[model samples]
Target: MSRSTSTPAAPATPTTPATHGPVRIGAQARTAQRPTVDPVVSGGFWYDRRRTVARVAIPQGPGLLESAGNLHDLRLAAGAADGPFRGDYPFMDSDVYKWLEAASWQLGQAPDGEHGAAAEASLAEHMEKIIALVADAQQPDGYLNSWFQSGKGDGPFLDLRWGHELYCAGHLIQAAVAHHRATGADSLLQVARRFADHIDATFGTPDSGKPVDGIDGHPEVETALVELYRETGERRYLDLAGYFVDRFGHGRLGGERYCQDRVPLRQADNVEGHAVRQLYLLAAAADLATETGDDELGAAAARLWHAMVATKTHLTGGVGAHHDEEDFGDPYELPNERAYCETCAAIASIQFSWRMALLTGQARYSDLIERTLFNGFLAGMSLDGERWLYVNPLQVRDGHTDTGDDQSARRTRWFRCACCPPNVMRLLASLEHYVSASDGSGLHLHQYVSGRYRGETDRGLPIFVNVNTDYPWQGRITVTVEECPDMPWTLSLRIPQWCRDYTLSVDGVPSARTQNEAPAQDGWLRVERVWTAGDALVLDLDLPVRLVEADPRVDAVRGCVAIERGPLVYCVEQVDHPGGGLDDVVLDPSRPLSAKDRPDLLGGVVTVVGAGYRRRLAPSGWWPYQDRTDAERGDHASPVGTGEPVELTAVPYYAWANREDGSMRVWLPTD
Candidate 1:
């Protein structure tokens, strides 16, 4: 909770947001622009995570791929070795491609990565080997997929409904794009283009004169094709991606809601089906809308996003609510202890939100991204980056039953499905790209971090700034302009939705606001002015710990509240309690809460100390129902000297399960 940072200058009334001065915002823009290069995650919180990824996590990938049979399957299919295909069957090849993408991003993280030239060399060497192996595994006609080539499953494209041919191919194309951008190497790009061309020639509508008129069981290929188009400047790939996006809900894949094929993309009222598939499909729609200016697609994406975030989303910003099929449950069906909240679902949510931000220039999109980044997605990976979690639940009960690998509460080195680990790897490696973006006129800092960021103007002139802060832990952000075009351009910083009040200073001088309590329209404070190097702006955001509540209809947590400070959602783990009664404890909201920096706990996090009462409970009857009067129940639940008072400690949800996973809960019963 505590770190050394410059004392921020006070501006405007501390109760009001500074939205009326040079910090005023501009018109929202939806442009077809994305960072083709990495943002400088030069130092601080993100720096450490990215460094661990490059030096530890990513370096460990190839071996995991080999041990998991990804590389072996490719070699066996290529006839370089004699063996059968192996690994997590349906999407085994996708994990390999995901790891390759992760390595490529780390190679491109810096001139030399955080660990220096040696880390760069290791990434390149691994990418070179995998890229060549992937290229060798492709058929002469551009077909690739080790499972079919190794004589498994019914041949290629035989079962489009269940077959993951396109899904795996999509990841391959994405890896190729990342590789090409990072290393300027075309070895993998060539393989991607050939297979993409094959796919284009193979699947289409009857009017397009193609053989197959179906989509894949999974919905990743849509987004992958768009990224491929961006990399290769090939309109055919973009068009192919559009075709796949529109082909959904046509009974091609049995119209299973679980596969996101139950309803047409634009006509759907809200998100449904598998959480990952829905988000991936929406992300593709956002891309198509941005590139082609398709209003219908844009509207659908926005509409579904509003619906999903309003009802289906967890406080941690994770989405999936069901474990059976990893699909979205009914609206207001957000459960705590039974929450699935798959790690892949959280990543998919961030991807979808990022694309939506690019398409709509909306502060709301970035707000969700920040929430997910700090909690849901961050929780998926261990601090050391060597282990990963497949499912992220909001609550883990005491004496929780041990499940199989994929559903286990504990983080593992790898899983049988193995999607979340590499999914996390690729996201962390490429995280810089998501931190900030430019739309040719203004620079938008959606997620704050300490680093050097570059934006651009319409003439392609670069605007660079060195940002310094401990952010997420502290509210002070100092953006010092390092370079600019000498002309005016907007510098917009997102005021997170969770922020209630803030102070702003321009050029170290206090600036006045319009006395508005929040930003005029949305949660972004923008400033447009002619700039020179060394000009600066400082914004000190209020990071008070506040209790949050869900809708009354979310029954599972109707009378409960969750804790949050800034963008981070906090949870109470049983390990931090040790008195052995987390379930019996009820928060005493009347007691004052304090925030203290715990450098010795969970790799140094800000801990919230609060008071709670372990309510004495009577044994439940066999029927588990009480006929007691309302007064009797109220007396039993009261926290006024009727229960044992206990001091409670809460930590960031992302840091849970890292020490010892006994029990953890975000929402606590309060009285």
Candidate 2:
């Protein structure tokens, strides 16, 4: 399934779908602005990536699911096949649901943009077959979970703490919503609603007096139930979601931090517990706040987000530093080599951030989304869209012991707990939905990508702005107002947090509206004017290599520095430094750092070359422990050999581990 080193061949498709089943804000939404057209990425970086997804990842999903016994479990639940459940985890069906979601998005996207007409038709055929298989598997009571249905878990709701019954249902409902919205097909939606009805009747609020008093160990069902309410306008569905959200922190699940039931949502000061579970629960909290316009809930959501950013988040916008439970650690306990920044957690972080952006209409939420998308989430999947990494670590030592089958030290075609690859697929397929949003009166560019952006004025008139850029690479973006209302409307372009200096000029001239060559507010450059056709503005953020040092509190890499250019974090792999491995390499900030475009390497990336020295350490001793004052005494352990000058080549962090198996580290020692 590995692809060639070069970019894959994509058919010529000028028109991509404008929206990939964007979030539909109901009247209950409290946000000041919502996305208007779901701005499509018809060209450039994301489009090309989507092309790779359609060509390989999305198409390969069904077969992999079949081979892994995901589909067989579904059939067995339906009494069509006789076998015990497949997969080590109980949540295997979620992967198929995710795959279905991705396939639906691919079918709904720009026709033939990536998939040829015949390919599209074939994909649709497989998608329908899978959908039918899922629909048939549902029990008469509308409950679905291949594991429990296979009689593998005794019965439904019996083991809510360990069983992922609700979690799997959540994914099924999400896939149904996506399918319904994308293709205007309600078959899956109908199945999902039946299950939702069953869940609503079974699970009860604190006052409902239902026999079942437990929530799932996982938090996904809460968010999915809220989305179902948004889709179906069933207040009961929303109430059920609220029930699940409120059920936390009452000693349920024994108040275990791993299950995120230890602290109440509104009272929690910081994010804790399993990273994905905590984020998913908070996402549902955001949804609850949005629909109900609860100020307290909204404040709590924002406060928790700030706490996570300041305490637990990685430089790559990844979370979950503890490897054992895939849990968040104490503030600044980020260990580079042992980081368990699970790929699913990164995706969950994006979901949470996007919801925050819509709820608050602030630029910071999108900022995290951009960082996670470019580095954390992107690093989870291979460039070829075949292999995937369950966890994304910042450092891998030379001869790193890869004990697990799906270890992060190397890419695996599939994981025993394979949630990340299909999750990646759905995100890439629906990426345009996260690019930009509108306030009903103006447009707001969130994540910068080269494409055709469409929004609208408050008066219902459509606005179109064509954007062209090399983006994340060369930072100059050409924006042309193709169509706009005669009335004045604002165009707010985001100045990424990484960008310290940039210039903006309109119609080939410096505009007088600029305020001291800086972003107007909240990392945004706002321009208000009565736009006309063909009016153009050029934004230049000439990307350059930057050396970033971690806070002293981050003990893992306090004296080290991570290389960055624009949105990309860079890492040195052992393959690139054949002479001296990355373990002992040290970067020197005083020396020159250069950025080079190497189309011949790693499928055409802009690599950063830096001046560094390889340290020669004392040979390992039987007793490695040394006194703290040894350096002061000039012991043999200190600087045993001369520092050898080495030219360090760093590729984008997302592109690491794509080559030969060797050492890799993002944060290099600078001392």
lDDT tens digits, residues 20-74, model 2? 2223233233334565454566666677788889888998998999999999999
Cand. 2 Cα-lDDT: 0.82
Give the Cα-based TM-score of candidate 2 against the true structure.
Answer: 0.94
On residues 248-279, what C-alpha lDDT tens digit does candidate 1 reach at each position? Answer: 98788887898878899989998998999889
> Which residue pairs collide in model 1, if any?
none
CA lDDT of each prediction against the hidden true structure? 0.81, 0.82
Candidate 2: list runs displaced more than 4 Å. Answer: 1-31, 113-115, 513-518, 628-634, 637-642
